[model samples]
Target: MKKIIITLSIALSFALPSYAFADQAACEAKAVSKDGKPLYGAAKDASIKKCMGDAKPNDCEAKAVSKDGKPLYGAAKTASIKKCEGGK
Candidate 1:
């Protein structure tokens, strides 16, 4: 049992950092304006905040797909969609 717990803990430590970095990248990518210009200062912050807040499940469908081309389901799907949508 201890080994299993330690293994799971180690796996999660590696897994979580990737998700965090991915989310930061997504937020930065979404912080741009529709006119192809990058926002700055409070505007950039606001844009990132809005983009994350307005994220929807459908918005992340493409990113939420499984390796076999099937849509993900349940919590995994939800987390994937949220991550893709730039939500924390």
Candidate 2:
């Protein structure tokens, strides 16, 4: 039982880093420009950052709902989205 547990733990440790790398790779693939060219420099960095933030299924904007379940608007929505997305 102990051996099985140790093996599973090892496997999970290896798998988790690859999962994060996959997200990064996918985000990088999307870092293109409006002219159909790949972005470079600060633009590429910013694009990848935004893309990674949106890779999650329930992203910050989607979670910016009011207490009554209605979608938030204006400054309220901005704050909610920022908080939900790790205050970025």
Candidate 3:
């Protein structure tokens, strides 16, 4: 059991870095404009931020739910809709 645990731990350590690199590549792929040009510098950063942020739900009404699983109400719901729509 001890030897199996150590081998699995070593294998996971090597696998994790590759997963991180793949995620970075995926983020870069998503950081392009609608015209197919890749964004760079501040543009790339902003694009990535918007891309990742919008991954949750594209619709404003869908994003009005709180992190705790409760639906937002009143000003909170309105604010969420505005922010989600503006990001697009």
- The C-alpha lDDT values of all candidates are 0.81, 0.85, 0.81
TM-score rank order: 2, 3, 1
- The lowest-lDDT stretch of 10 consecutive residues in candidate 2 is 52-61
Off by over 4 Å in 3: 50-88
Top model by TM-score, which number?
2
**Model 3 lDDT tens row, 1-88:** 9999999999999999998678777887988878999988999988766655554454778778999989999999878887777754
Q: Candidate 1: minimum summed lDDT over ten consecutive residues — where? A: 50-59
Off by over 4 Å in 1: 54-88
List residue ranges in candidate 2 displaced over 4 A.
54-88
Which is the leading candidate under lDDT? 2
Work out the TM-score per prediction: 0.49, 0.62, 0.52
What residue pairs are clashing in model 1? none
TM-score of 2: 0.62
